[model samples]
Target: MSADCLFCKIVAGEIPADVVHETGATLAFRDIGPKAPVHVLVIPKAHHADVAALAVTDPALAGEVLAAAAEVARKEGLLAHGYRTIFNTGGYGGQEVFHVHAHVVGGAPLGPMLSPR
Candidate 1:
């Protein structure tokens, strides 16, 4: 984990978050600054840093994170219609938080994607 990453701090309990779920290897929480009504995030507890960094040797760990995200989506009632999951890697994709996270968003109709503010 990077020394100054915001999410690493949260995972370390050095900061606070509206955590929704936590397991042996991951944590799920409500996104403080949400993009959609039901937005939430699933992150690896061990701190892998970024999606671009995932590798074949890490497949099992990576699968755990994805499964945890799906579990959170189902629990949040976002499945009957559908949900959108995204990982914004690095700066170009708008990853303000450096710690890798999967965004789980959807419930009601999203209407339209907002233009970047």
Candidate 2:
């Protein structure tokens, strides 16, 4: 885990977060800035700068992240109704934190996936 990464800190227990789920390879937590009624961030335990980095470095771990995201959605009671999973890759993609994480959002109609640019 990178000492400077926020998600890494949370994984390492150096930081506190509203965690929702965890596995040997992944961690899921509530987003501090929630966009939906249910918003969770699912991440791999190992540090990855972004989705691309995670994919290239450890593809299986990347899959684990996705699986964890689904689990979060299910646990949040949005699975049967459906939900959206998002990965903002970089700054241009709207990624604020460097760590690779998936946003699990649902619990209500989310409207359009994105606003018109």
Candidate 3:
């Protein structure tokens, strides 16, 4: 784990988060800043720079992250209506934290996937 990474700290219990779900390999927590009625961040217990890196280095763990996100969405009651899972890669992708995480958001119409340019 990267000592300076915020998600790593959350995983390590050094920082507090509104955790929603957890598994041997993953953790799901509510997002501090909610863009939708339900917004949770699902992450792997192990650290990776980003989703792409995680996919390349440890595909199994990456799949675990997705599974956790799906579980979070189910727990959040978003399965029937629908939900969105996002992984912001780098700065251009809007990833603030370096640790790989999946944002599971739903509970209402989220509108367009991105702002119309």
Rank by lDDT (best first)? 3, 2, 1
1-117: candidate 1 lDDT, tens digit per residue: 667888888888998989988899889999988878889999988767677665344777788889999999889988898898888888888887777799999877776565667
Clashes by residue pair, model 1: none
Model 2, range 1-117, lDDT digits (tens) per residue?
888899999999999999899999999999998998999999998888999999998999998898888788878899788899999998889999898989999999989988998
| RMSD of each candidate relative to the true structure | 2.3, 0.9, 0.6
In model 3, what lDDT does residue 9 have?
Answer: 94
| Stretches > 4 Å off in candidate 1 | 111-117
Candidate 3's residue-wise lDDT over 24-60, tens digit each?
Answer: 9999999999999999999999999999999999999
Candidate 3: deviation at residue 61, Å?
Answer: 0.5
TM-score of each: 0.87, 0.96, 0.98
lDDT of 3 at 43: 94
- Return whichever of 1 and 2 wins on TM-score: 2
lDDT of 2: 0.91
lDDT value, candidate 3, whole model = 0.93
lDDT of each: 0.83, 0.91, 0.93
